[model samples]
Target chain A: MTIDWNAFTPWSALAGGALIGLASALLLLANGRIAGISGILGGLLARQAGETSWRLAFTVGLLAIPSLWLLFAQLPPIHIEAGYPVLVAAGLLVGIGTRYGSGCTSGHGVCGLSRLSPRSLVATLCFMGAGFATVFAVRHLLGA
Target chain B: MNKTTITAFAAGLVFGLGLLLSGMANPEKVLAFLDLAGNWDPSLALVMAGAIAVGLPVFTWAKGRQKSLLDEPLKIPTSNDIDRPLVVGSLLFGAGWGLAGFCPGPAVVATGAGELKAVVFTLAMLVGMTAFQALQRQPQPA
Candidate 1:
């Protein structure tokens, strides 16, 4: 019930979100593709000719941007309380789930919702509900 | 590189920067937002709202176009039916997100920062994705 006002950074968050939206908009306007991280990454695995280049280019950009940002600003400190086993399990779940679900937060939550896609809405709700339930179970019931 | 490739690269760069600036690259920030029972941070809500606000109009414009600016056919998904795979997959993805507080985009961006945990998580996620692909190739029991 308590809000962490001290940790809250709405301005930056909003700015970043706007940047994300801008990125998606640009991609759609330029390439007509959804900025879905999973779909982009998954396509790389397929190794389809003519498709691999752009995916690789996009991923390389994703990897390179943060490194580039370090020159201008200090990257935020990362904190992960979960152990390696839990992290691996969670990673696996996310990978499989995003593939099966057809998209993740970016594709479904941002782009899909923006386009008013009902499937994206359902997918977003399910994932968000699951996130809430999982957090509640882990933090409250299991005390982990 | 071609214009399409250049565009993809630019989009990825912007997206990565957005993720970093939004505090999403920090797992603690994400976990705090998800921790509705404990100390919840609503910053992510603002992030989503801001993204949607800008995206809505753009998508509206894009919907009417048959082709991108690059002259390629627009490939937007048209399926609206909420199927079992969609629900189950989203549920599982949400659980993983809650458990680790690192979705695919942030995880990849974090890996770029040379975080060992992100490296491990990314590897595991690739393994999981590969496994899903293998599963899809198997024949269903009749």
Candidate 2:
């Protein structure tokens, strides 16, 4: 197996990852909340009074990123390999799946692993395995 | 906004920026990492490790606390079950992630950037989420 040297970015990845960790840590320390994007979004739909405002604010802050980032530099490139059909199907699966599973990459992968929750570990393994298999099937078998 | 609200906003901003800086916002980078059988990019591994390294200690400390520094209830997840829902749901989520490299975080970030593709994906994701909400309210078949 060949490593994609040109695509590999260790420093930025680590630094960015640390920033994500800091965000999660900050949320926990200050608001007593987990920085799970799916959970945050899901909570928005439930419409619980006294809970809606903070969740809305957090979402607004996320929406504010592009404007904020554009102030200093150009926004990063976002390459989408999938077409609309795939995107729609994928989006549906992701939404339903994360909610049903109770977490996603951020929840299960980053925060859950950090806390060393065995359940998160199991969730992580299942998702990662499925992801690897899906990619293999798509790239190698379907030849997409 | 209260202290909690402000901090949550700040945290979201930081998280969004981290996705941008760490290459997580870039679907190509994520796809490259996921493309295991191909020329694999191992950078995402370091990303996960770096996040966990910083997060582990903070979580461990938070676990012992009942209240946050801002006087809010510490809301760490308490569920320990590794059940059918978790496995099935995660597998479905993983397949979707593999099909399209956009996860919720980066998709929202990109949608904020006015990317049309992200717009489509996010809308569909919301619809799917709404469907889940509807399905959840249904009477269970015995």
Candidate 3:
């Protein structure tokens, strides 16, 4: 596969991954909780009073990061091959998967795996493998 | 206040930086890789490789540490069962990734990347996360 040299941004990617890994490590040290998005967000949905505040704050903070960045940097352009319906459906599916999986990629794939949770390992493998397969099918099989 | 939250936030910051660096926060770049026919980019593989390289060492170190901030040993799942949840969840996640070219990490990172489409994807993904929780309220067979 040919790469567009102009579009490459490996430095940013490294910085981002390092940031995520560091965050996961420090959060464990500081709060003693896994920073899995699904778990955090799910706790809010269940309306578990005291837990909701931090979760909300965490999520809000997540949204805030981008806003904060906009102060100094230019935002990237966006393009989607899928339609609104497809986008919505895909989101819904992800939501359902998170519930069933009991964690999103952050929690299971990143935090869970880091902690050496077999569940997270399986879940990460499952999700990542699925991702590889789905991309293959969509791009190669259906050519969508 | 809690150690976990502190660590999580830190990890997220780094993760966001990684996304920014990898060009993963960009939908067009991700789509190109998925394109397979057009100019396919494999830059993401390098990002994964870098992450694993760092992660492997960190994880090994953490494994040897006796007590964590939680006052207990790090919890690692022992089961290797490949159950329905694993299969179904993976399929769903992959499907979403393929269709949207956005996963949760980059969707969040995209906010910083300043992409309108990523914003939309992130909002929808949040809604979807919420919807799943709502649905789970019903008593369904485990």
Candidate 4:
């Protein structure tokens, strides 16, 4: 398989990843919480968890990022490949799956792996394997 | 806002910024990374490694602690049992990710940027989550 050399951006990827770690670290060290975005957002739906204030605050911050970034520099361009139907279906799967699994990429992938949780490792493997398989099916087999 | 809330807000900001900067917010970039047979972009692997590298030490330290610096209880999950639900759910999540290349964090961030497709995905995701919640609230068969 040929490598996509033009798309490589190791430095920025590393830096941005470090920033994510920093964010997770800050949440853990300061607030004693996992920076699991899905968990945070899902908790809001429940509401009886009594962690509304912090969750809302975190969400507000996320929603405010574009406006905030525009002040400093233009945010990088985002390209979505899926049409509305695929996006909706995919979104449904992600939303339902994350809740059922108890974490998403952030929770299980980065933080769970870091914490040396076997469950997270298994979860990560399952998801990653599924991801690879799905892509192979879509791009190669189905040829969509 | 309390310190915890403020700290959470700050973390959210950093996390969103990181997603944007790491190119994870761009579904096309993510899809390229996922495309193993086609032209592969290995940047995502580096991103995960970089994140885990920085996270490892901090989490190791946090794992030993009971309370955070802010005096809040450390909220690490203690469940070690690998269940069917976990595996199934994770596979589903991955399928969705591979299908759309937009996960929760990046999707929300993109929605914030007023991307119309992102808006659709985010809304659909919320509906999906709400559907899950509804299912969860239903009475189980005795």
TM-score for chain B of all predictions = 0.96, 0.96, 0.80, 0.97
lDDT of 3 by residue, B23-97 (tens): 666666776665555576666656555555555566666666556665644543345666887667766776787
User: Model 4, B74: alpha-carbon shift in Å?
Assistant: 1.0
Interface RMSD, all candidates in order, equals 0.8, 0.8, 3.4, 0.9
Clashing pairs in 1: none
The segments of candidate 2 whose C-alpha lies over 4 angstroms from its true place after superposition are: none
Q: What iRMS does model 1 reach?
A: 0.8
lDDT of 3 by residue, A38-125 (tens): 6766676778865655566556556556666667785554466667777777666776677677776677766666656777777777
lDDT of 1: 0.90
The residue-level lDDT of candidate 4 at B102 comes to: 90
Number of clashes in every candidate structure? Answer: 0, 0, 38, 0
* Residue pairs in collision within model 4: none
Each prediction's Cα lDDT score? 0.90, 0.89, 0.64, 0.90
**Which DockQ-derived CAPRI band holds candidate 4?**
high
Worst 10 residues of 3 chain B by lDDT: B3-12
